[model samples]
Target chain A: MRKGIPNDPGRRDRLRAVALEFIAERGLRRFTVRGVAERAGVSPGSITYYFTDTDELIMSAFELLTEHAEPNFNVRLRAAGTRDEAIEVLIDYVIDPDDASQQEVRAVRELYSLGSRDPKAAALVRDRLEANARTALMLHFTEPCAHALDALIEGLWTQRSWNDEPLDPGMVRTAIHGLVTAFDSLEGTSA
Target chain B: MRKGIPNDPGRRDRLRAVALEFIAERGLRRFTVRGVAERAGVSPGSITYYFTDTDELIMSAFELLTEHAEPNFNVRLRAAGTRDEAIEVLIDYVIDPDDASQQEVRAVRELYSLGSRDPKAAALVRDRLEANARTALMLHFTEPCAHALDALIEGLWTQRSWNDEPLDPGMVRTAIHGLVTAFDSLEGTSA
Candidate 1:
């Protein structure tokens, strides 16, 4: 079992933060206790003291990544009064270059890469995505539509990252409007 | 410039195949000349002879991954007679477990992880995605809709992968239907 510190939650948090930075800057395969320790200005023993297993540390870092993202999404989403506004908010979140920093993008890619091979990690990613869909449901989207919207949002975010040139905002908005219109049409249907 | 093995194209192809398998099984971060050497049953020096730089070897492996995926997609896509059928083909490509082997999924995830850091790699991934969109255009989808559909297909495929439980085929089909119907509505629009 991994041991937990009775105090110094801040230190544990710092270690996890540094670990995520390590993952963001370097690939996950290169992660090591010593690497994180050096960055955190702590000894290797100090890191092991909080989390006995490296997997546990890595997972903790992933959780931190999620925790950082959710609140920001929630704040903007909760502020929207109507479904259309919410949809626009989601689009803005995806297409706005400032919304997800490069560090966050890198961390997400690393975690998703880990998820590709590890079911437990996959579940963590799924939970976040499903949570986004669930929020969409609250905004009047049907279940399937909500899920599709969630997928579209993530896909757009990823696609934007890959393009060397900037995405034309007008085209992106139009494309998403088309999708959301489709989902709206299905609102009264069985789907 | 990287040296070309003009005399033994077969040997060069074998090296790329082995490198891709190594990437699929392990990961890019863990890829090393010695590691690929043992797996390929060749000496590390011989591996370097083919790929003077490790980055060159990794990129070639990625190209091989794309080559394997594109033909399967192209054949099915070309066979679709209408836009609706093309969409179905795409959805099947995503939902069908048999379509993409687990190895392919792992390798793609690893490459996308690399793309998160490397602009050149990002371009490669973007090229494959844009190619899919272009095929959608040939099937009569509008430019914006084609790009949107491409993003949706990729998003759904990724979403399905994250789910540990089997996705209900009916729900998956319905979700895609809703999105496509919207794209179709915009068929003649300037978008």
Candidate 2:
């Protein structure tokens, strides 16, 4: 372990963070171990010694991203005791992401674009989707409604990411509220 | 003027179509006039005659994409006589896109990703967003509801594009209904 270049745990973590940032800055297809090594000011060999392959490297970066997000999700979601609060949680965590960076959302979207072609990347996206749906269900949303919320979060995120301006919270609240009401009506009819 | 290798209007249209397909297949960062020429079986000089610069080529491709989409939107939207019919049109045209191919969606997303850094691209995206919202409003959705519908369409498109399986139409209907209901209640409250 030579300062920031070798197989230290901290160095390994730093490489993963750098890899994700690189993908976020430049699109996923531009991601290369050598590129990440250059950005991190370490030799390619030093980085490869820790990651071995680019796929492993990208996967690790994704793991780190989820690991960082998981706790934030848990804390906020755990605090929500009502449907209204649950909507706030979904908006903050997913659509608007007041606590998350645009880079993080971009990185995840690049991974999602990859999912259209790569099976492993697809599995990760599916896992995230399932987890989101499960989160909504835990908040007492019906199955279809939970998926709807998840989809809305994803759709809004895309819209928000592309535009330079922040979405009005008032509008986001109304949209989410609309979805909930629509589903509530459906549930009422089916029941 | 020589078959498919000159400044002919037919060849120009073909080049634009090829450029969009190339971006959809290989992503926007990898797009090159030469690459599109190769894909179109034309020479780079021939392409330059129609589009002197890559920016023009890309913008032209974006224009062609909209030209193709606009008629579909107009025809379908014009036929929708009721709220439920409007929902069905939206689902078919935006969410599930029964008539549109996945390639079209991917190409649009590539342009949207480009919007984050490029001002021209950003304008195009904003235009598309505005147009979608306008369509929703014309369906008698209130202002906030129209925006919400646009966001849901965008969000659902993102979800549907990334996944291999088609989203269940029944589930999609429920989600859209939910948002509309929520907004309807708000409108009623205000009235």
Candidate maximizing lDDT: 1
What is candidate 1's DockQ?
A: 0.53
- Find the 10 residues in a row with the least total lDDT in model 1 chain B: B182-191
lDDT of 1 by residue, A31-97 (tens): 8989999999999999988887888999999989877864555677778888778877877776676
All candidates: TM-score: 0.87, 0.84
- lDDT of model 1 at residue B14? 91
RMSD of each: 3.2, 3.9
Fnat across every predicted model, in order: 0.50, 0.50
DockQ of 2: 0.49
Q: What's each prediction's clash count?
A: 0, 8
Q: DockQ (Cα-based) per candidate?
A: 0.53, 0.49
- Model 2 TM-score (2 dp): 0.84
Binned by DockQ into CAPRI classes (incorrect, acceptable, medium, high), candidate 1 is medium
